[model samples]
Structure formats: C-alpha cells, structure tokens
Target: MKQFPFFIILLFISSCQYFEKQIPSEKELLQKELKSINWKEVDEFPSVVDCEKVNDKKLRQQCFFEVMAQLIQEKLDIDTLSILYPELDTIEVKVTIFPNSSMKFEPQFSKDSVAYDTIKIDSILQARLVDFPKVNPAIKRGVPVKTQLILPIIIKAKEEKK
Candidate 1:
C-alpha cells in the first residue's frame, strides 16, 4: 500500500513537467511571425475607387493597373513629351504609392539613353502627374502598406504610312 502511494507521487512529479510549458514572450512571437511572412508580395494591390468593387484578386490587380496606366497616359497626352522626343515611343515610369495615399512618379531611363534630356523629361512627368483620384493603399496582413509599380507608358503611336 505504501509503495502504491510512492508510485503515485513519482508519477505526479514527472507529469508536472508536461503541464509546465514555457510560454513565448509577445516580442518573440511577433518576431517569429514577421520572419515567416513574405515581405515582397502584398495581400492586396493599391487600387482606385473603381477597382474596389472587384472581388477576384487577380482581376482587381489588373483593374488597378489598367486604370493607373490609362490615367497616366491621359495625363501625359496633354504634355509635350512626344514633341520633345520624337524618337521616344515609350517611357518606363516607376510609381510609388504610400500608405497615406500619396504617390510619386519617376521616369526610368536606360543607360544608353544619353541623347535624351532626362532632367527635362523627369520635370515634365513630375509636373504633369498630379491630382489623381483617391488611391487606396496596398494591404499586407490587413494593414495598409506602401507599394511600388513599374509601368510602361506609350508616348505616341506611329501612324502607318499607306
């Protein structure tokens, strides 16, 4: 009978370790979660009011990109970029959208584009690209995040000579 009681005490002492699990600190848990996340991709792309109604993720992204490109094209059409650089048919623009809904547009030029006046083109783009429709910032893990997109804008289409 005494041995049975001793065995019970030993079992209880050994089982205490199974119940005593070391809880991780909040900071440690947060750091671990952050490490597991892929920072390169966002859950949702930055969008305009028109694209917000889109339910499909891929379609929504496409709508946002299309709208942005169209808006940029329209805005630049009023500028003299085509006249300034007749040979330049396309311009690669780097667009940065902030979490606060503000945006920045920068022209990307190739290394061989030394003949083009990059400063003037950049100034024209900066001056022309403004007052856009309200853009909802990208979402990552349910939080608003800044995102950047590279879009190619057609300066002017060549007319086919008959």
Candidate 2:
C-alpha cells in the first residue's frame, strides 16, 4: 500500500515536468517575434503632452507597442460585433482616445437595449492625437510616432421586424 502511494506521487511529478517542458515562457516567444520584425521608430507623431515622461528609448518603444496592441484589440472587437450580429440594425460603436494612450470601445444599440455592450480597451492604443508645435520635444525623443484613427462602427440590420 505504501508503494502504491509513492508510485502515484512519482507519476504526478513526472507529468508536471513534461507539461512544463512543452509550454514555452512568454519572454522566449516575445524575443523570437521581436527578432523577426524590422522595427522602425516613428517620428512624425506629435508629442503627447499629458502623459508622464519616459526615461529611456526602450521604455518608449514598449509604450508604443502597448498602444498599438490596444488599438488592434478595439478593431478586433468591432469586427467581432459585425460578425456576431449580422441581423443587428443601427449598431453604434463609440471609440475614444484617452490621454494615456488608451482606447474606450463602447457599443451602443439605439434600437435594442439588450444589444448594448460596453468594452474598455486600455494601454493598447498608441496616441492618436499628437500635439504639433510640441510642448516638450524631449518627450518625443524616442517615442514611436503613430497616427490616431477612429472608426465609428455602425452596423445596420438589413430588415426590421414588425
């Protein structure tokens, strides 16, 4: 009986180690992808006046990446809504750019209250509005410049039910 318990413990440990070996760490994956991209810094975007200053170039790059990720997420949400509600009529999606390079995605259904869905996307969108005639040129030192584009998603139903 004692042997049986020991054997079970051994099996569990071995299984865990096997699974751990199979799953790659996030850092490893990110490094691999980063290597593939020919990264180019964006300088055309106007400096963000409100955000706290970043000290290093790497930090700035990371910040821009975060913003881009958020923007992509918002786009995905819009695409998902369109797919999910093909019959939906007059779907209005509100997209806003926050000061900290974030996006708020809110889907408001004017016709049906049940269809309303609010989604907040943060830290994933790069600054859309760049202040020209920059207040702080130093803030733009290493920041990747990106244009902010907002697309209000409105999906209308083809036919209304009487």
Candidate 3:
C-alpha cells in the first residue's frame, strides 16, 4: 500500500480553509437594526397661513402656534362669552387637524361652577372654527400627518381687576 506524507495531508487540510463559508444562524435573521421607534411625534408641526416661509423647525413651530392663537383669539367672540358667563375665567379646546385639512374641536369648560351651557359654547366654537382657513397639516417622513393642539383661552370679565 502506498503511504501518503503527513506534511502533504496538513497542507491539503490548510488549503480547504479558503473555501470555508460563513452561514449565519437564526440569530442574525432575528436581530433587528432598530427595536423600536417613535411614531407619535411628527417631523413638522401644522403650519398656519404665512408661517410656511419660516425654515427653522423651532421658529416654524413657534410661528405656527402664534398664528393659530391669534386666529382663534380674533375669530372667537370671547368677550361676549365672558360677559355672559362671568364665573368661568378659562376654557380649553382640544383641536385636531387632519391630513385632509379639516379640523375637529372639543371644548372643555369648568364643570364645577357651571357658568355657561357647554352645548351653547360648543356651538359657538363650531361656528367660529368655520371661519378659520384650512392650514397645512403636520408632516412625518415627508408625508402630511394629523396633529392635535390644546388651546387654553382665558376670558376675564370686563369689570374684573387685572
């Protein structure tokens, strides 16, 4: 029987390492680049008229909020409400802007004092919002997104001391 040299066998075994393949196990497939993400926050906030020109994100947000507050303050008949409901000094409205440019509002007044009828306030709010111009909605990943804004309005009586 012909005998093979042990050195030649070692050299052949070493050369086989070049063809060795790396087969990833199930762990590689199960591992994720990102385990979680924040979907609630939008990349851009809803912009009001004339606020689109602002480029800085923080400034844009500020302008948006300012414009919205101004619009609501100008449009709503808060003075009348203050005169009618002397007890309620503050009110909160939860406004939501949808991607379709439509808005939804939920008015919240002080329930303990019961100064004014909420139904009447709700109706007045709805009518006032009708005059508000449709605004550009928030954006997320280059897509328009729905956003919510809480507006707190303080209505003081005309005779009350500051």
Best by lDDT: 1
Off by over 4 Å in 2: 1-83, 115-151, 154-162
* Candidate 2 weakest ten by summed lDDT: 120-129
TM-score-best of 1 and 3: 1
Clashes of 2: 8
Ranking by lDDT: 1, 3, 2
Model 3 over residues 1-162: C-alpha lDDT tens digits?
144587788788999978898877767654642234357788889987688899999999998877877777666644477777777666788889999888888886654746468898888778776667768899887989888988876665666534
**lDDT by residue (tens digit), candidate 1, 1-162:** 869999999999999999999999999999999999999999999999999899999999999999999999989887788878989989999999999999999999999999999999999999999999999999999999999999999886334213
Off by over 4 Å in 3: 1-35, 110-113, 156-162
Clashing pairs in 2: 42-145, 67-124, 67-125, 67-126, 70-124, 89-157, 90-156, 128-148
lDDT (0 to 1) per candidate: 0.93, 0.43, 0.77
User: Per-residue lDDT of 75-160 in model 2, one digit per residue for the tens?
Assistant: 44433344455654333434444334444444443444554342322121223222222222222335533334333433433232
Candidate 1 vs candidate 2, TM-score winner: 1
